[model samples]
Target chain A: MAPTTQTPPSLRPSPATLAITRIVLIAAAVLFLAPVYWLIVSSTKSNPDLISSNGLLFAGNNIVENYTALMSWTQGNFWRWVGNSMLYSTVAGVLGTLVSVSAGYALAKFRMPGKAGIQLAILGGLLMPIALLTVPLYIFFNGLGLTNTIWAVIIPSCVSPFGVFLGRMFVDAGVPDELLEASRLDGSGEVRTFFTLVLRLLAPAMVTIFLFIFVATWNNFLLPLMMLNSAELKPVTLGLYGMMSYFSPQYGAVLQGALLSVIPLVVLFFVLQRYWQSGLTAGAVKG
Target chain B: MSTLTRPTAPERLVTEQRAQANRRRRRREGRIGWGFFAPFAILFVLTFVIPILVSIRSSFFTEKAAGDSLYGGGGMVETFAFLDNYAQVLGNATFWEGMGRVLLFGAFQIPVMLGGALILALLLDSFIVRRVAFFRLSYFLPYAIPGVIAALVWTYIFSPGLSPINQTLGSISEWLTGLLGNNVDLTIDFFAPGTIIASMATMTTWTFMGYNMLIFLAALQAIPHDLYEAARLDGAGEFDIVRRIKVPMVGQATLLAVLLSIIGTVQLFNEPTVLAAVNPWMGNDYTPMMLAYSSMMGTTSPSGAGPASAVSISMAVIAGILAAIFALVQKRSTR
Candidate 1:
């Protein structure tokens, strides 16, 4: 690490190379940020301004009116949708993280039977796209009388096979077996040893797992759409989709609402950008 | 007092025995492992396994609606329609056309998406790029937005009345129409059938390019830095470094992304579904999954729950087969 850290001093590029690299970087940045820029600009504009003005340019005067009209557009249903999204994301994120972390710890630390079966199941779940399961999940939930509630959203999310799989790999690699044995020898109970001692060391992995689950659950649409019938219970994705259906004639308002719905996700991404990157990279490599 | 303090071997043995019993108790406490995995097992089986079985069963049986109210009354599930639904799906020209469209979409999309991602990843990994963290995060921002929201945002951009491009084209069209009076060109309509794939592709590329880019970038970062230094010393250019080193190193990541993209492409639902709501041309049955949904729950008439299930099962099977083939190929290549 020390030797590699010193190599950056000698690594310098010529002016021509720097110019080309800068152009590439700037272009890439623009390509990525164009939709977001459109989103922000469209959000502040009213129906007329959205139609007339340049999408990329800012004529940021309609912010207040847009917010007011958006709030009242569906009789205060938008805020209710936001609340439902929060409830679903928060519950699913926390529970999913817990299940993943604990199961990971067990699989990493123990000599339990059927570990292979569980691990293979997780792999299968990871490989199987959630779309294939959505219909089946709906039918299953319907049979069990679990459809149309926050529990239906939260329940299926709790078994994120990818999370558990990633968490297990993180634990096995990051937390040493000797340390666990030492904790056991010191007369600490397994759960206590895990939560109080091992958890501190597992912070990075935990953060990564939490952010991934949070983002995934926040972006979840199919399951929620299939399960929830009540508009009030719909998460923001389903809610936004419903609004888009009605906003066919009012393209400007649809754009504004679409942009509004993304604010939370943008905030989340910015806050956890580092964790998200490292976690994603790690998962890809291991995968 | 000294004699009492110097006590016995039996006392030490008794304490040692107690400690062993305590160790035994700790060993027994391992059953709490079940407590951890119990919830996962129950939910996994209930949600994933059972539904798949039910779907498979439903795929074979034809639901004959006997009563006046087709839904409320007696619907019978009968024996094997032996490849009938598959035959229908194959014979149904719309299903084949949708499949062809997605194939074209996949062809156009996979290359553009993967290419853009590869370029971005390579550039970001270069030493010349400033603020590596900022570049990485910015590129990945689109994926953070919900698919539904992403589609909605793109829809607004593509809207005829509000779109900037539409206005630009409208002005050009007005000039041309004035010059050539009453013989106006029809190319101004942005959602024309010829252009719908491009529209949908643009939206999809925006949403997922960053995600794939990040995966590639991560793979790029994992490559040994010394490889680049070695190439530079050998007078290799930047392009050479990317071509020879970065791409080869991240082959597995690329392969994984391909498999994932293919699976997602087959399940194409949200983009077309949302777009169809806006434009009549991009109808409800714009894709196979959409076809299934419309068949099962269309406002027209509820026809063929059995066939819908069959189509769905067929999709699942094809996806499964492709996934298996990819997995097998990946395993072999990696080995």
Candidate 2:
């Protein structure tokens, strides 16, 4: 909701209170941005310069060196990890969005037996803490001889019940019953109707769901840690963590890698703020 | 006799036609619905249901070191050890200690974070704050940063060698010592075991406070403007308006945020796990999830899976119980 342009005269806050609010807000913003500021600043400095100089201020002109060294570290494996992360998240996001949205549309529009039970199960799955699933999933994948492969990460991530829940809400809100009925009355098959009629209306919801799933999979560390082993298969998070364990002397490289890992998501987040915000509130309110 | 008991022939014919058409449509709808639902159902079963079942089943079994199997020189055998792993997990001091630590963390962190979020949301929703969009984005920027990176960034800030925080504290302590003419260590050791929890809590707050604030803001926006207008007309002050109207109006959302926080706190892993790399006090068994992870990874036990399953199941139970309790309380309050 947009804020009203003009406040009623009677409801206007006093100048002193307004000033205090502004000051508090600005202080909080600075506190929130402080670490990010430090991150960006430190990524530009050399390891020695990082320790010797003021951390809050810009000091060294070693951005190129730091990034070059970061890229070349670990036999240039950082770039590979970034590639693997991008692949896994993208595949999972697209495929998961498709499955969840289709199911959600069906559940919302079609009359089916056991519909209530299915919806309830989705809700329960949403509430279940995924951290608890890591161990069993590891065991399961280990049994399947799939633990070290990217499939182990992508497969489980593709089944987000929250996405399904969001999909149902989006469909219910975005798609009208009359449109589906009209398509059906025209003798269009269920699949065709969905593809031709409902899919366009569902684009915004799809983007929202896709972005959410992408971010979740992109940020996922525990699953990859539990499932993958080879250095080449590691995502950015686990890759950075592995580096952090032994790269104490080269804090510059680690900071650079961390900053690099965060930059893509931050850019995407700002670009898709509207969809992401609505998606977040949608789940919280409905689920 | 049949004709007398039944409806007229025309009516009977119409009823039969309608029933037949309805059945055909119902069957078609069912087919399409099931067809569409198949993919998700199959994957959900494979990933979620199967793992949960396997965990539940394995939680009741204990791994025994068996002699050479047909294909292997040594193999671990799982025997039906009902309640044994559960007993071990429940009886372990470290497990309870981790649980206690998390409970304490939640108790302190939830209030401060949620309270801060509520206040911020109120301030933004009020007429006093301008440039709401920029402020909202700035506040929520941390949430976009992954938990792993967030921890890493904060580790830089907490590092004594690299942190501006420590540098600032160092000068402040030095100034204090000079003024008092006595040696006083006033600088905060963020990595110290005693302060690690608070430090971690602060990081957690930093990451989640804005996210929660957005939820509260959404709820606040949903409140009808007329209610606020009415309150203002009745000579209600800003504090009174917030207290009397906004808070109660957002009760459901507040409860939802609280419940989600409870579930989230119970499963706290990523932040502490990342921070443990920099801080020695945060051991492998720092939280229940970590303990379970360490156990599952065979760091804590020779037969790790059984005990790890028990630990995970226990965590799930605790989360479910807490969620149920919150739901009950919220229902009661509403009633």
Candidate 3:
């Protein structure tokens, strides 16, 4: 059998079949990246060049112009949106990872009261289709005067039941109980053991959960749309969205902004690609 | 699981004292475990339980104005309305139509995307291509792209004047028109309301197919290597091995992919919303989620929070039911 997610070979094939499969795979990959290619090409053009130039070819070196223009659209508000997005996604990633890791470790490894109930709650949460909660959460947050505040977006995002589930699974598979027992025997506390040994063991799962939450918070539009009204509080997703009404005229700058906004995540994905792949497969293998 | 000890418990100690000590340790461990779990539990309750309880509670009630005009009321009053919200949501045709549109959209998109993903996984796992890592990474790269950027780029690409698809087809259509001695319009306007769902589906599939492939690929890799050797020893062909071994082994992952796709796509917002942002023809009620949003967002209306909450609840219930049914069918089929 093939190693599931890994690319190491399995079955031998005839030359014809190999050639056909290779062609098909290459064609598919090119087709997949075609839009991103279009965006990259288009982002370098000014508005006039965008109209005149070939859709898939660079027209001029207008990257700086487009970047500055997009940033200056609302008096450098684009920078604020990017900063807000980074802050929310990063903070949410850290907080979500911490809660998920600890909760997962506890549920997976500890002798505890109400474990099943907590499990049930998280499972129930998994079914709730989190986006639906935005309206009610908006209501509650508004009642508490949290609307138009940063907490409106970050607070609701702080918990991801799926992360909790994955974390539990990770703890069960990755961490050995014997090691915890040894730590206790060596006079290490639960907090110390978790921070020292369990944290190291769960690095992959931590990255997995962090990336998931980070992308989610970065990608989120509705929560911010509902909770936030001020321009300064907007994350990049909603900020670009708010700028899209005049999209046809500002198409170049808007496209540039969108692509630039997404680059951080792409870079993050590249850096953490190895761990996330393994962590994800761990879920599959264990399941 | 025995702990290494500096010294054994004194034999002179009474059994009760030792038992009590053991109980205290277990209790202390329980406290620590509870401590570890405290943050999630509190957050889950605040963000999950309270929202759910209050939403459900609020669904049975609505806010009414104190006067004849909804706007003129000095103070809005919250009143028990029984299942009025649920009934209204059920009676709302546009909302149901939006629901139907999303369901119909998912019906075709989910299967085709998953099929593509599975095939890609199988091909990658088989190593028919030498650059397995390169191809895998290429397919998976789109997963990192934000859905908004994907939608915007695709929307731009699919728009009539900006679209290369139209330009390419325009040339072809001119040739066909000349060949046929009449006008032959092969150029497609991909942003029209009629084709918005298909456009949405394309962007969605483009963004997600790789993610699904990763899931399937991961499952494909987990199949035991011994099983393939045994099948080969029994004279099974490559095709036979894939069908009889690889596909069967990854059924759980397939089910998972399907379920996740269902849950995720059922709440479809970003693509349609982005498309609608440019193409107003798609309207605010393009999907159930959109309808829920649009309901709460009018200047003259009384916030429409009641109706919006109802729609949100309805979408959640429908998605839950679909997911449950899918899980059950998979369970049954596997058994």
Q: lDDT for each of the candidates?
A: 0.77, 0.87, 0.82
Q: Provide backbone clash counts, one per model.
A: 0, 0, 4
Among these predictions, the greatest lDDT belongs to 2
**What tens-digit string does per-residue lDDT give for candidate 1 at A1-287?**
11323545445667787898788888878977877887777777777777777767877477777766666665588878877888888888888887788888777776566778887888878877677677666666776898887888888877788788878888888888788889989999877987887678888888888887877888887778778899788888888788778753345555667777778878988887788877778866876
Ranking by lDDT: 2, 3, 1
RMSD, every candidate, angstroms: 6.1, 2.3, 4.6
Sort every candidate by TM-score, greatest first: 2, 3, 1
lDDT of 1 at B131: 78
The list of candidate 2 runs beyond 4 A from truth reads A1-5, B1-6, B68-73
Worst 10 residues of 2 chain B by lDDT: B64-73
Q: Model 3's chain B TM-score?
A: 0.91
Summed over model 3, clashes come to: 4
Per-prediction DockQ:
0.44, 0.69, 0.52
For model 1, the DockQ equals: 0.44
Worst 10 residues of 1 chain A by lDDT: A1-10
Cα lDDT tens digits for candidate 1, B1-335: 85478758888788899999987765664466656666667777876778788777766666565566857367554657767766777678777777778778888998899999898887777756557778778878889888888888887778777676676667778889999887565435557899888888988998999889888888887877788879989988767887888888898888888888888887788889788878876777788777776665543223455567666776777777876787788779768
| Candidate 3 iRMSD, 1 decimal | 2.6
